[model samples]
Target: MEILSFVAAIAVGFVILSWSADRLIEVASTLASRLGMSILTIGMTIVAFGTSAPELLVSSVAALDGSAGIAIGNALGSNIINIGLVLALCGVIYPLVVSRRIITRELPLLGLVVAFSLALMLDGDLSQTDGFILAGALVAYCYYLARHSGGDSEDDEEVVILSISTARAVVESLVLLALLMGSSKLLVWGASELARSFGISEVIIGLTVIAFGTSLPEMAAALASARKGLFDLVMATVIGSNIFNLLGVLAFPGILSGGLKIDSLVIQRDGLAMAGLTAALAIIVVSSLSMGNTDKASGSTLSLRRAACSYIPRYKSAILLACFAGYMTILGISALA
Candidate 1:
């Protein structure tokens, strides 16, 4: 009966999650197009952060509720899922053709964050010092990305401005963003309550259930773009979300929490899982190139067949799922023991 209840909750949650995610992407993309913003910027500021908002909101609420473990776990688990499951699935669906810029910039920063996160967790808790350090890195990273974004071309920025006036664009963007935010809140509420009504642990619920819940927009957006042959948009949505997870999802909760705390075991396990997955992603990128598969070597430039071979060893998602399984196994065993 308990298992049945959990399954039922998950089914409903998945439906709501998918519906909400579609709405989010629809509104965000429409607004971005209306406001003269690029899809990349939309993915970075609006869509990316919007999708991650659930994790941020849940973590903040968990921290305030004094369930710091849930807060920390949600943040860490979501990050792992964001990079591993989300990116891996995106790649599998349509190989993530790297931009030379992404190869030298975004990938390296991701690796650094993975390393830095592990170093911070070398201590039992993520103290204020750690929080500030992480936050500072985030700011620096954003600054770098802004400078190197290679955006703001005369034609790119100018094209949108001519289509819509600034005042109208601002109003439309705000209204759309508000609707997106409100729906997301409803989705999160439905998810948490449904999870509790079942017998699922909040951590597991957060890792698998809610993580996938929030990622729905990216999944849908990417697939739609893939079908439409808008491959750059797909890559932007996938890679841009990764950047947002680190900057917004991970950073927001720590600042709001006053301090972030995790069990040493949680830190070690989740940290290793994230790092291992990130390393696998890098290997997939490099190896795809070495094998004369330039499709994934740069953005939207690879052939379909080569792009398919881009994610060899596919250990990012597999390892994360395995580690999650192992973590849950230990949890279940410990509880039963």
Candidate 2:
């Protein structure tokens, strides 16, 4: 097939994948609720994981297909995009702010998950043992979140409860699951083909094309939340997606492939970059607008109209974007090598 044909397949795959993941998550959450799970629990666990369904499904397929580099890269690359792309872009277009609640909760949990996952992979092997540990961590993290979230979320954050019959919901969920699987397979095939046709490594393809593609939903969600200054939703959307990426998406390669051997550059370069960026996000999450601010906008030029610590300032947003650009450059150089 021509390159454009491959690109078209990937584009269609991402659209279908996003739609299927959303419907499936809603149906799954409803089923969970029927099984006695709380709304807060559903929001924290199902919704968060569902948002990352693209990455998780993609990685799982890559692992199963023996394309472990793409699996690993999707996991790490998506996390980088979440912080450096999605979060930064949101801050740039809106009066973004950091929430104290995020600083105390989701942010730290994300940091812990990233740190643990990196430590396990430092040996350059994504082994089943590593997968087990990460999976256990994910389970423990979910338990913590579910227990702490209480019975309901009374905050400004809204959880939509769908009114639907269980039998119909189950049927709809099964259909969405099939679509999700098919789309993921299509995306993986297109991405692998594109990588081979262009002489690009799977890791680079996974990091740039597939990573950004998987993160599109996140960028949309974060920007929407930032537009309204909804701190909890913004943080939850990004942080929650990221946490699951590390634990769930990354773990798939290890478990499914029975311990795949990864590229050294993954640990030496991409892995460290991911770790550093997470640390940067944690630091930025606690900072307020008092640190620095640009002058107000004039003559239709854009500038910060609000300076709030509980909100991110323009300069910090710029920093995050810079980090993203620098990392992309690194990926470019590595691909050429």
- Candidate of highest TM-score: 2
RMSD of 2: 5.7
TM-score between candidate 1 and the true structure: 0.72
lDDT for residue 143 in candidate 2, whole number 0-100: 82
Q: Per-residue lDDT tens digits of candidate 1, residues 28-70?
A: 4555566555555555555665555666677667767767766
Provide the TM-score for each candidate, comma-separated: 0.72, 0.77
Candidate 2 at residue 233, lDDT?
A: 56
Q: What pairs collide in candidate 2?
A: 96-312, 97-311, 97-312, 98-310, 98-311, 288-309
Model 2, 194-231: lDDT tens digits are 77778988889889888877776666445544554444
C-alpha lDDT of candidate 2 relative to the true structure: 0.72
Which regions of candidate 2 deviate over 4 angstroms?
A: 7-43, 151-192, 289-309
Report the number of clashing residue pairs per model: 1, 6
